[model samples]
Target: MADEGTSTKPVRPSMGSMRSSSFLQDHQQYRPPNKPENHYGIDTVVEDIQASQISSPRQISPFNGIPSSENPPKIVESGVTHEFSHPNCTPAPGSRTDRLVATLFYRSSAPRISNAIPSPQRVPSPPRAPHSPKISALDADIPPTMAPSSSLETFPLEPPSSEPEPLDHLYGSHISPMCITSFLHLMSTFPLPPNSPSPTSAHRCLKLSAAHENHPEVVELTLSPAPSADYLSLADLRKHELIYRFEQEWNVDVALRADTLWRRYPRLVVFDMDSTLITQEVIDLLAATITDPPDLAARVADITHRAMLGELEFDSAFRERVKLLTGLSGEIFTQLRQVLEVTNGVRPLLRALKKLGVKTAVLSGGFLPLTSWLAGELGIDYAHANEVVIDEATGRLTGEVKGRIVGKERKKELLLEIAEKEGIDLQQVVAVGDGANDLLMMEAAGLGVAWNAKPRVQMEAGARLNGESLLDLLHLFGFTEEEIQQLVA
Candidate 1:
């Protein structure tokens, strides 16, 4: 594969019926004391009462819904707002007296004003009536220093926008909006475990920060509330839970992980062969070569499943299964490789990875003859597995491992060896496997992806891809749709 690693506020409570008697009583509580220093030339409260009392039955004020008393300095009469008969009411619009009284009026009348304009968390958060008025009050309280001379008319009272705080969990590396959002909604439906909920200010928020998030090829985003500990980090547990959802509900055939960085660029990729790289288990196929005990094939297949499930140890299972093939013909090895079905999307993925110059390897617990052959066919750079001994003269299976069995531990060692030889850090290596034995190496790599792995492995791997095609792996590395096409093409 020519795939190169690619890149990836709460508001205050509203003052309900702000002009209600309760509010006025509270306002009087905090209002400037009636001391000499508090006595300004104009008294808005007294003037408001006087204006209401003086109004005649037939008199129609220019300010219809706006009460004359609510006007701080003077009320508009006959459309002559410019003429103030009282010398004390001639202060400029931004005067402290004007600001103080007008600001109070602006806030107290929110129930009426907000009904005219609904302010949702204008950007990401939904607008709730309880918080909407509080937002307006904040807007009205412009710092006097930041206000202009005609602050009443030119004040920056437009609601200051608040952004979604990124969830502690950050996600990136996706193909499109539909690809990412559907995946997210599916995972979010997963029931969170009983972590004693720690009430924090940053719940239900998110941020989009990927350089190419909206690009047809890549999507990036940051969400909050991730697990802090690295050991069985909440990430791994979530992956386990996500795997359950993938298999059960929602025909979603893909796995989407929320990670700020799944090691943005991986220099090498390693895979396990049996159920991962190919569809048929080589051992089960080899067992089929035996015609005796009619149920021999069935027995070997069961053992293989248990071994992969981690119920039976790999070495013992491999030996027990191989012993059953004591007299198999050598020619079948070549024949087995011929009929091996590559998992969906493997060809294009390998071709893309090769083009990107990422080293690829196969670390198998199966026989080496088929392992190496598969690696060569797929253009993989390295191969390691157990080699079975055969009788030279008869050209048939001897049913014995020639060297140290390349079991779970050996697979991990080989992975580290390959990465070390290439001068790459473990973080730049990706391990893909689907068996209990694959867990060690998967844990050892920077990003361990469970490719349709067993339950145990799925529960522990760093990331899991539930899709049928490995081609989506390209998307995992943050490749754009166009770039993937060019590489595969």
Candidate 2:
């Protein structure tokens, strides 16, 4: 009787239903579109076109419990006249037919989606492809802007494309066709930066040909067809890949000589006795040694200053300065030599050049007595300075110079003559000095380096080494770091 009562009562369906009526009832539940068992119709919402323009195809995947018998992707071909053919698309609740049709309108006649024509859209658009296009020799001739024809031969692996490729696939993204053509035209003018290097030079080339300010470590190698046989400046050569750029600070492009310029120059370099070898106004130094006439010394010094700066003619300036010191003593040479200070970097540079077999020479406009003493001290090889005309009886200045002045033209003639006598080519010569008088000598040599020179000399000379020690000339000669080490050691 108790078991029968428990089963028969139906339990009055209970207070649980009263407390959770909405959760148990199916009235407010959502039924999924194609799955009757799944009460919620969460996937039944229709997707409306945001804009009336054609858009890229959307790929759809099946929702769980939706029948796989239905094909979600409806592929419509361009110009082939596709008909709505979804076999399982039943009519929506309000529609008489199952087809959700979209009318095909002509681009010229249809209302545009926006002010600008969005790039052409197609059904079943392709996924993104690789960066560089694989172009065959035949395909290279084909215009990049044209669509690949609907033939299997066009894109070998891709089957005869059922519809024409979206114009975006043939051309590129939303950019105008005219803009693309302009871009290609511009690219044709200059070679692309990436392909500028030579293949063979790139392989074995450990060194770069040029220097760029931004990339201090990496050498820049610019390769083009070898230049035609014609003369060109360094700038011209750089334009045509004939010369490479070197660091301005490091190489100091003053002169380019034969490979052995350091080896064959003057063994005995002779500088002028006055301003050539020493800073003391030579005539003034002579005056200082002879008498304590500071005023006459200052006047002679001013004349030399004008001459060195190219203000006065060399002959006129020489005559005036010499006339001022007409009656000095021969003993002045000894005093001047003792007091003279050699120019900076002379010792160090001479030592470096001596190691490389360059003997120093000093040709001077001043008296020989002081120069000869300097020759022995600095190990100079040759000394060609003026001889003071002394009274043979008294050993006093006779108010006259003994030899021809070592002026501009004479200096040049002497440089070439000395080069020939030393068995060195003129091209292997390196001249260094700091005056307008030195300009002719500098031009006569292979590498004329103006050392802390006046502006006029620097402008006329081949290379100028200003505000730097003379030892910097070693770098100009292409000395390797290791070679410099051995030389210095």
Candidate 3:
């Protein structure tokens, strides 16, 4: 009894793995009609399959150790193989099954160049296809002649033969480059300077002559002078073989002429005023100077965008936008007219246009006061724009537009009017503008451009020029690098 005070109970082991005695006692919960205990039967499945059929390299569980009964692996023929566990995943018929099977067939079917005894040399075809019999007959056709196999051994050493061949015997079904070159050399007697502004004149004549010779479809040809040769006609030439090279020579000469003509031709140039000819949007600038309500500029801008994209009727959109600024004073127009900055390329492009006699004009939907001011500043011959109305009593904006709004249709009218007045065809006119209202005018011109236009405007325009400088406009007329540089200089 002396140590009884410190007596303690012994620690007990855990019984958490076993079911409670109460679980076995509750017969109704275990075997109730509505609720019953479930068994997965995983152990029963393992017991039914044969031991040898099972593959159990690693034990999965202590009490229910089992293995899967899948078939053993086998070697497949050469080709790609993709095995799937699902029966529905099999490949379709004719699909390569194994990599080895595919690789072997691929290598067997591949073409190989052999180095065994060399084969006899095959005759090369002439570069051109034969012309139709009727076409050849019309040109006083020359039959194709084959150069001897041995004769080709020394190229460039053979001197050029100078004899005109009948038009029909050229290499390709198309006009021969050789013939073009020869024809140009023959026509070199004409005053076509290599430095000529344009050879289109010479090209037209060559094209006409080629048409008469029965080669009717000659559109483009590039020619270079061949080794110097005496020019001789088909009847007078001693060497008949040179006729084989004549077609290609003719193509060369005609090409040179076409290029010369294209170069000499005059070009039509156009300009877009907002951020193109001029640095700022005239409408927005007008709005800002007039101190319009904040919402007024945004609404005008939205309508302007819709009009430019063709989403809204230009007249309606223009009227609606102008209505928003109904109370703005007219004096702001005078102020904007003074502060406007001509964009980088305006002066140069105008000078170049004037120097080249390019019909130059300003097509704007902005106010006429500013348009006229700019037209005079750059020396442009024509300017078209809307007219802002002012109340005589107040000298402030009557908040109304006067005359034609110069919306899309009006712009189109102005373009046609200018073109007609100048006695120039629509094809000779170029229209440039940034607004949606300018689209119709641009469309009527030979080249209609969206200059730094909104996204909606660019897609409708013939071309979109967003460059920082305007000289790039020269490129549209097909000016060469040298010519552009000379003009800029």
Candidate 4:
């Protein structure tokens, strides 16, 4: 044989497209049994659709020239089931379903299929034309991706400029700010300073006639200034000095925030019946009615005074005092009622309160007989007090309290209960008292007035009326001279 060099060139397959069936038949031996029954029917249909897409003329693989032994992938009617394993082509490890899904998706995507297409040559695409002048300036300003897809127009996100709104448009100049005005009203117990000018030039003085001929001489001083930031504090300071000076010198009782207070017009006015609404302590009077034993009367009076001054507890002192009246005739109550002296300003004050449709109540630690009589006489709306047990056989007091004692706490409870019954706010209540037992009820009220109270009570009270007349309280609620005259009329 002639010596010849062995051909070294590798033969390339003809550059012709292979039929889809022939390509799939080549890998038939590698096909697995039908997919598990659990596999979704929709997945199988999706696989078939992808296979049809990949079989198109534009999607032929460029590496089809490679022999099956050279790690060619196995193609099924659905798609490539498995990629051939070789030193350079290691298949990704996954469940059979995952592999099938991935293969289906890979062949279905147009871009992926185009990239995998076996193209002999690539041609460059033509450059895009520039936008025409007929297009809107706004359209030219927007990028192609962001431009509106349809003919629908778009608006700018914000206005190019803003103008200030006219003040008249927002709020009419005729409008005024919201406000609450309080007026301090003062009335004299005596006629001193009959023509005195108001403490401040901004304030005015209104003279008021006595509610009755027998009532004390009275006048009204109205303090109304433009509202200020520190109006309450300044008013309090001014009123405090005004009260101290007039009360000390001219015997005037000053009432602050009276105007606003009168508007509320307290629905209830609770009085401590003993010393507040009346000049006498009913219990002391009862004890004094026992002339057969002077020492017992003195002892009861001493205990009562101590209790009122906060020395002894009112309940215990009251029990001790009532115990001494055991053998006293119940008929004495009638005589005591006859002698009971109404406090100087009480009748006039009650008259005004009643005229205003305000409810009056007497909360007493003394016996109910006296309180009931007083309440009836003054047309009081309510009365609560301790009941003195009586021996019906003898027509005399048994000296034992019959029911719950009406102490300081009970007084407060009754006040609250009454307010609730009347459907009024506690802020619309006025409590007046003169002793320690009256403090709690007074404290519970919106306005606690200590009327010639003990040192402790006067110190804690919201307002104090030291003059002889309780009618001074009317001024504190902003009752004007004309209003008082109208009320009296």
Best by lDDT: 1
Q: How well does each candidate superpose onto the true structure, as a TM-score? A: 0.55, 0.48, 0.45, 0.52
Rank the models by TM-score, top first: 1, 4, 2, 3
* lDDT at position 4, candidate 1: 66
In candidate 4, where is summed lDDT lowest over 10 consecutive residues? 98-107
**What tens-digit string does per-residue lDDT give for candidate 3 at 394-435?**
877765778877767777887788777777777667777777
Candidate 4 Cα lDDT to native: 0.61
Give Cα-based local distance difference scores for all models.
0.63, 0.50, 0.52, 0.61
Off by over 4 Å in 3: 1-272, 290-292
Error of 3 at 11 (Å): 99
Task: List the candidate numbers ranked by lDDT, top first.
Answer: 1, 4, 3, 2
Task: Flag the better candidate by TM-score, 2 or 4.
Answer: 4
State how far residue 203 of model 1 sits from its true place (Å).
Answer: 18
Write one digit per residue (lDDT tens) for candidate 1, span 1-489.
445684333567886675543334445544465544333224444545443323246665454353233343455566676533332233347642110000000011122212122223223334456435344433432233333334366546664443222111123222334434544554454343345232111111121223544432223332323323343444544555554443233222233334434345778999998778997799889888788989999999999999999999889889988888988998899988768999988899899988888999999988888998888888999999888888999999888878789899988889888988999988788899999999999889887788877888877776666655667667566565567789899
Model 2 lDDT, full chain set: 0.50
Worst-scoring 10-residue span by lDDT in model 2: 98-107
- Where does model 2 exceed 4 Å of error? 1-277, 289-294, 480-482
| Residue 401's lDDT in candidate 1 | 78
Q: Report residue 9 deviation for candidate 4 (angstroms).
A: 99
Cα RMSD, each candidate: 30.4, 30.0, 31.5, 40.0
